[model samples]
Target: MADEEVWKAIDDLHAWLDANKAVDGPEALLLRVLKLSEEVGEVAQAVIGATGQNPRKGTSHTWDDVRSELCDVVITALVALRTLTPDAREVFATHLAGVTERSLDGRTP
Candidate 1:
């Protein structure tokens, strides 16, 4: 998918969530940001399950499950960033560029 489409989807999801949410303002934004932690925990859980690290579960989840959970983490993070600022696309792009440069070009802060 194009970058524009991803931002559009994030905007749409944010709008739908804001409309349906009982709380608004800073509290809503806090909750949105906190949701990222929950999604990240699921990713960890999926990884554990996929790797059969949990003796009780024994490969309950496949690698595809881990992939889906990771996607959820990304979506939750983007939505939370959107909640924080309307310029999420620009913000993410700028941060990504800096990261790429630092990692690939051996740049230092």
Candidate 2:
């Protein structure tokens, strides 16, 4: 999603939580981050299984299956971060710009 959309969703969730009296500030944000991490791990597991690296006996999965779970990890991460920072846009803007610049500096061509 776009940065603005991410922030809007965060704002909406914050409002919902506040309306329900379930807001707990940083503690709640941390909990969501932990949950997001778990989802990311699942994505990694899916990747491993899809590539025959799981080694869990007969464990296996398809590329399509892994892609769906990988998307889950990304969505959970953006949502969780939105809960933490009100300026997720600035954060992504600055971070991604620097990363892209540095990455381009190392390109082979």
Q: Pick the candidate with the highest lDDT.
A: 1
Q: Per-residue lDDT for 63 in model 1?
A: 98
For model 2, the run of ten residues with the poorest summed lDDT = 14-23
What TM-score fits each model? 0.92, 0.68
Residue-wise lDDT of candidate 2 within 1-109, one digit each (tens)?
8856766776786567556645477777677778777997888888788788756644587889888998777667766666667776677678878888798995644
lDDT tens digits by residue: candidate 1, 28-90:
888988999899999999999999999988998999999999999999999989988999999
What does the lDDT read for residue 34 in candidate 1? Answer: 90
Task: For candidate 1, report its TM-score.
Answer: 0.92
Clashing pairs in 1: none
